[model samples]
Target: MIGTLRTVVLDAPDIKSLAAFYADVAGLDEHYADDEWITLNAADGTRLGFQRAPDHVPPRWPDPAFPQQLHLDLRVPDMAAAVEHAVKLGATRLPGGGETFTVLADPAGHPFCLCQSDGDSTTIADVAIDCASAGPLARFYSELLGLPVTWEGEGGAMISTEGRLPVIFQEIADHRAPRWPDPAHPQQLHLDVEVADVDAAEAAVLALGGVRLSGGGDNWRVYADPVGHPFCLVW
Candidate 1:
């Protein structure tokens, strides 16, 4: 494994509001906060981060042009109560879902699923990503994070992490891979992967079909997986 999954960060125009929205709906607690970044701790110990992107462009899910690059799967005991709480917290219902799940967009306009849960409390079940082919991306993350491919099917795949929340990939025929730093094709979210040796991790990542991205610092370096999703190698 190249590194451990650190945190799943989302780009938001208003970090405060977006962070609060999740905290309320998913029972996350604010761990840290600032003007540009906010970190929240999920009940299951997953870290959810929000980064300020002043001119962030919200995704238009189900639309290829403004595709939803990523989303979160929230599991709650009471589907009806969860849906109501989400909508009341400025979330808007979106098209698509079944008996097991419902789709809705956050105030930032990122689509997420409210999945019915057998457990009592609400928690993030998965960090779902959109890609042209699920198999490749799933394999990439599986190797990088050392997470096993728990499931795979026609159009989707899932990688089980140490935490209860796993990372899921779904096939999007017309997926529009984001061009980072470009507001037009904004990268709505990214993963911060923790690594012990940045240089060694970089070598391994590149060898595993990863590409180096432009910006980074001493503690963190940016790279994109095989399918063009940005992720950071942080020590």
Candidate 2:
């Protein structure tokens, strides 16, 4: 494995507002904060972060043109109450849902799913990524994070780690890969992985079908997984 998964970060024009929205709706606690970044700790040990992006462009899901590259699945015992609560927190309902899951857009315009869960309180169950093929991306992340593939079928797959939330892959018919650093194709979200040795992890990631995108600093470097989703390896 290249490294341990750190935080699932979302790009937002206003980091505080986006972080506040998730903190309230998902019941995550404040872990850290700064002008440009804010992170929250989920009940299951997962960390969610919001990064400041002044020129952020929100995705318009159900429309392939402005795709939702990745989204969180918040599970709650009461689906109706969860949906109502989310809507009250500046979330807008998006068409299409079933008894088990409902879709909504956060104030930042990022799409997320409110899933009917057995758990009593609201919690982040999974971080879902849109991909052209589920198997390959799932495999890439599985090796990178050292998470096992818990399920695979029906154009989707999931990798689960014991303490943190699982990451699921969904095959999108019209998936459009992002060309980040170019605002025309913004990366709405990304994963940050923590590694002991940045150089060694970089080698491991490249060997595992990841491409070096750019350098973050002495301790961190940006890379793109096999399917072009950007991620960072931090020491």
Candidate 3:
């Protein structure tokens, strides 16, 4: 049987900047850093990785032309405070109503939501991504979301923060890149990272391994990893 979710990997043009943004927003510690990759650590030992890619472009959300196939939902104690913190860390706020949860974007422009939850920190809960090589994707995401890459395995990787939320990445032999604006070849998945300053966060992602796809001037921006996975950063 498949185990619990482990790591969440993100592709980007810059790895260092994205990793720094996530590290600042998620309140996690930086574990590893290099020219091509960065890793962070969660309280529970889960990890997040961000890898570099030169031709990365973020997606425009709510637009059918570049729809979001998959995204993340985060839980927090205070939505307003969380959003404020996220914005300060370089996240943008989407145009929408605030109800049960609030939506935000990462430096790479991947969409993610914030809510409130009460559960055991040690229990493996929430989203996971299975990829071909955990190293590249894990490093990419770790930098993008400020999450940490906790574990690395032959088949997959694990990323998390504060021992609460964890996003996992699994290895795939033949991973196919997603094509935006085309329903048939739409993006398969995406991620959302929190930050303090939207502009600073964007810059950080660019410095690491992510490329900005769209929405640079507005509150939200779209970005893509080196492998072409769409993500966002919202203030």
Best by lDDT: 1
Candidate with more favorable, higher TM-score: 1 or 3? 1
Q: Which stretches of candidate 2 lie over 4 Å from their true place?
A: none
Residue pairs in clash, model 2 = none
Per-prediction TM-score, please? 0.97, 0.97, 0.52
Q: On TM-score, who's better, 2 or 3?
A: 2
For candidate 1, report its TM-score.
0.97
**lDDT of each candidate versus the true structure:** 0.91, 0.91, 0.62
- Residue clash pairs of candidate 1: none
lDDT minimum window of 10 residues, candidate 3: 1-10
lDDT of 1 by residue, 1-235 (tens): 8898889999998999999999999999999999999999986689999999999989988788998898999899999899998999999999999999999999999999999999989988889889989988899999999999999999999999565468999998978898987899888999999999999999999999999999998799889888888999999
**Candidate 1 wrong stretches, greater than 4 Å:** 161-164
